[model samples]
Target: MPNLLDIELLRTFLTITETGSFTRAAEEVHRTQSAVSMQMKKLEEMIGRPLFERGARSVTLTPDGFRLLDYAQRIVSLSEEAAAVFSEPELQGQVTLGVPDDYADRLLPRVLQAFARSHPHVELVVRCEGSSSLGERIEKGELDLAIVTKCDVGEGEVIRREALNFVGAREHATHLADPLPLAAGPQTCSWRRSAQHALESVGRKYRVAYTSSSAAPLISAVLAGLAITILPESAVRPEMRVLTERDGYPALPPCDIGFLRARHARSAIHDALAHHIVTRIGNLSPAVLADAAE
Candidate 1:
């Protein structure tokens, strides 16, 4: 008989991909790092192809691994759906969620739609704030759940990895200015801090021509060629273009979108909402979202 792909192994594979490292994936799957490594070896042996390209500190999917990911995700999702139909309850409660302004437009709608379909009785109270503020609220037990952009490897299930890009209006020569014009949020924002740090590292002279806590005006400033700003590639507007090293911008570090659940009593409703958020984030457009775990 042909060796079958175990559901548990597939789950492990998805976890590893989503978390970017075996160590993190093991924590989520309740396995030791060596055990996770052994599982990957077994899966690769059964499939007759290596699944991940191992790095000293991180791992990336191989081409064959990427191909298998789609089927694995579908299989896992269908399995969950089947189980939920029989084992899950009709969850009902008000769940408070917080998201950063930059991600609100990109990730919020899908999460809302998924929750609406899966647990219609659950009411979603969402707060839009900077990631730093959201993290603080989650820590203070003021929220049921929050999706936050972490500057470092943060707590909770890792969903998506975001590469910060320097973006501005298309055909805009604002970057050519001696003291580059920039539009950014307050210093508390990771985007602004990373942008400034990158510029200062290279000894580049820059000026914050526009600042806004909201996404609307920041995008407007970039579109109007008033300044360039650091943003995740997914958040870039249609009229905006990413400025690269050749375009006189420095590379920035990658960040992640992770969730934090309050350390209080949980409900089936909360779990359902969290699941929906993860699924939606995993389904983001591949072109813009690169190096994500799931």
Candidate 2:
């Protein structure tokens, strides 16, 4: 018989990838660092290949480890699903999820209505904030899961991609302003970074004309023609106008939306909610997107 891969070990392995270090992984798994090391060594011996490329303070997947990633995720997810079917435990617990304010108005209602209908017993707590702040909260285990805008220095499961656009109010000439006036979230925003880079690439001048941590206020400034701003395609209101290459604005990078799970929290409710989110929010299918827009 072929040797069976231990689900617990794979679970630990996934934790390490999310947390970025053995020390943090051990903390998440409630194991000592040495025990985590031994588990990896044993797994290596079983598989006849090394899984991690060790850094001074972090661990990245080796090529072999990357090969195992999809398999591990599927195996673990299926195992949990199978267990839930047999055990049939009522998913009754409080789960805290974070959502970036930039998307809250447009995306939250659909996600909430679907989840609440199916799992009424589960108490859901939501924190609305900037993606950068939410990402930090997720890493520190303050949030059970968080939706974030993908950035280079962070890691998450990218679930959706949409074009990030240069947007101004319709019938406004804000995009053509000299040292273009821009409205955006605070300095930490990824969209702000993309806007700056795109402008710099084409030798365009711009200044931060307004800054707000909340999307509502930022949109208000744009609609008032105070400044132009960046927004995901799905988030752009009908009243807003998109700036295109024909308008002399350089194209912006595509925005990636993804989720991060808390390294330490594993529960049926969490998995169920994650599944709901992926099914409902992942692709933005035509029907789902249309309904969500309503």
Candidate 3:
């Protein structure tokens, strides 16, 4: 029989790639540097190719490593899914989840889908609002859980920090307008605040030409060349163009996205849901995994 690839080795490989250093990866995996080194050696032997371009201070993925990464992630996800199917009992209860308007179309589906698969009996009630409003709801004990974005220091477990970008339509020149047109959400939105502050800091003139609380209208505004909006890097679509420093858009600070649990928690069901959410979403990316783990 051929040598089988190990899931642990794959995880370590991903950690190393994400952290950009073997030392950090070792810390993440709770292993010594030498042990991590040996695991990579064995993984390379199993694949019969060099996975990393080892350097004095850092290591980078070789083409073979890059190719294998996708497969490894899929395999690990499937393995975890299979284990979870039998290991976790069918749970029953209601969970009220709050998310920002921007992430409803992107992050919510994955979280709800994973919960549905493992805890079919649990009822999920979802509410969409701005991050600040969502945090308030969590504090008021109206929501069981929330994923919120914060401008400065965020509360709760930060899963990732995504850079903000000025996005415009792919073929549109709306960003070229004098006193650059901006499409923004409500005044309370952190992203909007960050965008305005960044422009002010750079002495750039901008006006809120379009305003919408929902993503569709904002996207439409950008597509029609009416205005450009600030969005997290992950939210940038192929139909959109990301305007950088060269495009005269000032660099905006990264947004801290985190999971906030209600202060007055209730049952085991909520705990299970929280654990499931953290694990499943954490696995989505290396950066998220590292942060969620911490």
User: Number of clashing residue pairs in every model?
Assistant: 3, 0, 0
Q: Provide the TM-score for each candidate, comma-separated.
A: 0.74, 0.65, 0.76
Query: After superposing candidate 1, which stretches have Cα over 4 Å from the reference?
Result: 1-61, 82-87, 152-157, 282-294
Which candidate tops lDDT? 2
Ranking of all candidate structures by their lDDT, best first: 2, 3, 1
On the 0 to 100 scale, the lDDT of residue 203 in model 3 is 88
> What is the per-residue lDDT of model 3 for residues 1-294, given as tens digits with 9 covering 90 to 100?
888889999988877767767778899999998999899899999999998776554456778888888788667766776687798677787889888768777767777887788778889999988777788888889999888775522578876567789999999888888899999888877778889999899888999988877777888899888999988876788999999999988888876788889877658778867866666554334422222111
Ranking by TM-score: 3, 1, 2
Candidate 2 wrongly placed segments (more than 4 Å): 1-89, 284-294
Q: Write the per-residue lDDT of candidate 2 for residues 1-294, one digit (tens) a residue.
A: 767999999888777665666777788999998998899888888788998766544456777887776677667766765675557756788999999877777877767876776677899999998887888898888999888887732788888789999999996878778989999877778888888998999999999989998888889989998899999987999999999999889998898888889987688788888886775566521111110000
Scored against the true structure, residue 119 in model 3 reaches a CA lDDT of 77
